[model samples]
Structures are given as C-alpha cells and as structure tokens.
Target: MVDQWKAPSAAEPAVGDDKSWKLLEKTLLAGVQEQRRARRWGIFFKVLTFCYLITVLVLFTPLLDMERTAVSGSGYTALIDVRGVIADKEEASADNLVTSLQAAFEDPKVKGVVLRINSPGGSPVQSGYVYDEIRRLRGLHPDTKVYAVISDLGASGAYYIASAADEIYADKASLVGSIGVTAAGFGFVGAMDKLGIQRRAYTSGEHKAFLDPFEPEKPDETKFWQGVLNVTHEQFIASVKQGRGDRLKDKEHPELFSGLVWTGQQALPLGLIDGLGNASSVARDVIGAKELVDFTVQESTFDRFSKKLGASVAQQLAMWMGFQGPTLR
Candidate 1:
C-alpha cells in the first residue's frame, strides 16, 4: 500500500485513496498561494522603495524651477524670503541668502528683488555678510531695486540686513528695531556645586575658556567682554545711521540702543522702516514683481539621514554612559 502511494498515478488514487489525494491537493494550493503572496509583497515593497527614492531625489536636486507668473505690464521681480536665525551653519545662512539674492539680480527676467525678512535676529557676522552682499548686488545691478519687507519680527541682525535694501517696509505690528548686540549664557557653577559634579577641561591659553560657566568669571574678563559688546553696538549704530541717512530722528530716545523693539507704526516716523507693508504687497505694488521665487536649498536624504543617525547615536551613547551633562548653548 505504501509503495502504491509513493508511485502515484494521475488516473486514480491508490492505497490512501481520495483522502490522501485531497491532502496533496490542499498542500499544492497552499504552496501556490504562499508564492503569490510573497510575489505581491515583493512588488508592493519595490513600488514603495521607488517612491521613496523619487522623493529623496526631488528634495535634494533642484528638480523644479521657481514658477514665474506675469505681473502688471512687462517688468519682472523676484521675491526672496529671509526667515529664522541667520547663522553660518543654519539653513538661513548669509552665504545661502547672498547666493539666492545674487542669482535674482543676475537674472535678466528678474527686474528687481523683494527681500521678505522675518527674523528675531542671529549672528552679527552672518548678518554683516548679508548686508555686504546686498550692497555688492546693488552696485552690480544698479537698475534692479532691492526692497526689504519686514514681516512679524525684524530685529537686530535682521534689521542689519534690511538696512542694505533700497526701501524697508514693515507691517503695522512688526518688530522693526533692535539695533544692539548681546552674548548670553548661563552659569552652572551653582548647579555643579549642588550636584557635586566637577568640570574638567584643559586649554592652551588663560582666557581660552573665558565664558565657561563651570569656572568663575574674572572681573577683567567681564570688562573685556563688555568692551567687545560696546564696539559691536557702535558698529551696529553706525551702520543703521549710514543706511537710513538723514531719515532717522535726532531725538536721543533710550530705546535706540537699549535693545528695545518698536512696531512698524512707531518705526515709520522714527525712520526705522520706509513704509508699512508685507513682501507680496510690496512686490506687486512697488517692485511690480508679483511672482515669487524660493532659492533655498532643500536637505538631501544623505544629509538628513546622517544628521539623524549622528544625533541618535550620540543619544544612545549618552544613555549608555549615564551622562546628564547640560548642553552648552
């Protein structure tokens, strides 16, 4: 009977009969179904992978050009947005801003540039770079008008960049002025003492860790830093005066250099801004460039992944080591 079952014939069931045939049939069907499921899953994953790759490409590459729209008459203008902290390593870096601005001015189609600024301010050096670039672009393209449109908050470094524009416009409620410099930090020496934690750091120079929170700040060091701030503040004031020319009021208001912000309504008369308006409105009405262009660099997959991976690894290492060190700014 076992031999008959082993040497099976298609014509009829042998030895084990219909029961055995039925079991074999079920097994064959299950195998086929499993293969079909696997194939479908494979196809699905392939399609998903394809979509992911496409998205990565689009984000990294300049796949799409800024959509150009026709404005009133024939003149063209480009709207460039300046948002967030302007730092060397940040997304809104002066280098990137300058490149975009320069491109806008260079474009034959782009008649003028509308610098839409909305920033709380950042690095003085970065702001100065943008300021210099704006001046250079204006010199290169004298015909193309560069207008600054302050959105919600344009202060300190933000205003520094705006001062270079041909005309500065701000919204009624916009923070227009903060013509000052500041270097902020926290002293964790008290916390360290309370927690019984010791900070060990070695440096080559005496003033290398001048602002180190762990170490006690020297009076001379504090005085030296204050001098630096004063120098930078004077530079900021001089730049503003030079940019605004005779428009600024002669009144010696404490707010001018006290790091106090002013609204657009107050700014207009104070000569902090040229008028009260936003980027789109100013672009359409003043510059005659209704169409906007964003030249910001989108992060690549490699960049995003690397950053995320690095952060994750660091977090894991910190967790593993049981380190609870506070972040240094």
Candidate 2:
C-alpha cells in the first residue's frame, strides 16, 4: 500500500502531500473562525435586541392605563391632572382633558371629577374647547360634581377653564388670575441696519405688512396693532365676566381687568378663586372619596425618546452648520 501511494509528481502538484494536509487544515481553521465571528455577532445582536425591548417596555409602560385594583365598595374619585401649558399638542391638551372628563363621567363608581390644574395657560381656542367640554360633560352627568383644584400657577386660559368648574380651589401661593391677551414681537430695524441687510418685502394690501418688525414701525401701524390687542383683551374680559357672572366683582374692583396675577390667597378676596386647597384634599374632603385614579394620558416613551433624539440631532446639525441661537449658554 505504501509503495502504491507514492508522492505525486511536482507538475501534478500535491494531491495528498504535506501541502494538501496544510491546505485542508487552513480551510477548516478559516471555517471555524468564520463560524466564531458569526456566532459573536449573533450573540451581540440578540443582547442588543433584548436590551432595546427592556428599555422600551420600562419607558412606555408608565404611560398606559395601569390595571386598577378592584374597588369592592361604592363611590370613587377620578383625579384628572392637567399640568404645564394647556396646548392642543401637549399632554395637557383639550383632547386629553376631554377624554379624562368623559372617562370620569362614564364610570359608574366615579362619584365626582377633580381637575388637578397646574398650568400657565396656552392657546385661547384650546382652552375654550376644554372649558366647553367640561360644561357639556357636567350638564350630561348632573350627579357627578366637577371641581377645579389649582396648583402652582393656573392663569390666563387656565383660569378661563377653571371658571367653568363648579368650584375652584388653590394653594395660597398659587398664581390664579391673568384675564388678558397679549401679542409681542421684536423690532429688528436697528439690528438689520447694523448687519447691513435690507429686508425687501412687498405686500398686496397697505396694512398687510402692518407689524413688520424688520422695518421701522410707523405711528399708525403701532396704533393699529394696539387696537388689535385691545380687541383681544376685551374678548378675554367678556369671557371672564360671562363665566363668573354674579361672583365676579368687576365693578367693585377697578383693577379686575388690569392683567395682574394674584396668589390664591389674594385671589379669594378678589373673587378670582373660590378657596385654598390641593387636589388630594379636594378629592378626600370635598369629593368624599379616598381612592383616586389618574386619568391623564402620560407621555409615551417612544414619543419622549423621539423628541429628545430629534432635538439632539437637530442641535448637533445646527452646531456643525455654525448656527447659534440668541442665548448660547
């Protein structure tokens, strides 16, 4: 057998020579290496996927309607927390408030609804929608009482919504009133001149560019803008008067419509707020229920992360593009 298995000729190359064994070993080693690399990547990706799922679960789970403990007994108080600016886009939106209100009214166990408001107000239209919804819900469910409990600051449109409630309560230090409207714009005529940049703007109508800040503000234009502001202010005042009615001491206090915000303590005397209290106290003492369920739709993790990521990417891109904001700090 040894004599028959002679080494192949040089021209034929190594069929089963030392080189052949070496080549086969190299190929096998390469295959093993490839498999190891693939397995490492697979493990890494699996771990990454697991981590991502865990993070999303932890972050988003809080926003969903957490399962409630079974209420064996009778009456319940549904707590509706309305925090931050009352804008349509925000968590404390008109839609969110309406949904919470509807839930409270629909729940048979929920005896009353307590609106826990902690906001500085937002768009007039948004606040108006919320106010109207609250009134409508109350009318539809007459038995269920609705109370507005203010915390921190609830002014302007916030106060407007609160006025629709049966009773308004607040902490003494809370800012309670700002019955007014305002529009502000920067006059950049001087800045433009300094920068040697002219804002060449054209309009079809004479008053179309009435409040153009890049150009000099004409005396007539200023007067026109003032008139617009006055009209909006009048509307706000009218709403307040209508909402409060006999309770408003507009005639007795000349400064009622002066856009002066007052503390909850000062507000009580001025008839801006009913009394001083928080949401918990109102839920327990006033509503006569201990169990409170928060009906506010908390911000979802995906939304929060997306916003943060978008902002971060935007900031990085802006920095790379050499763009600076008004306050660099």
Q: Write the per-residue lDDT of candidate 1 for residues 128-210, one digit (tens) a residue.
A: 89888888889988998889999899999999999988899999999989888999999989899999999999999989988
How far residue 318's Cα lies from its native spot in candidate 1, in Å, is 26
C-alpha local distance difference test of each model:
0.78, 0.79
State the weakest 10-residue window (summed lDDT) of model 2.
320-329
User: RMSD in angstroms, all models?
Assistant: 10.0, 9.2
**lDDT string, candidate 2, 1-329, tens digits:** 35666766777766557787799999999999999999999999968865774587586655443433345267778888888888877867888888778877888888788888888888888888888898898889998988999999888888888988888999999988888887888999888889999899988998898888887889998998888879877877877777777887778886878878988898888888777888888888888987777666655434444455588864553455343322100
Superposed on all Cα atoms, model 1 deviates from the true structure by an RMSD in Å of 10.0
Any residue pairs clashing in model 2, and if so which? none
Which parts of model 2 are misplaced by more than 4 Å? 1-44, 47-69, 301-329
Query: Which of the numbered candidates is closest to the native, going by highest TM-score?
Result: 2
TM-score of each: 0.73, 0.76
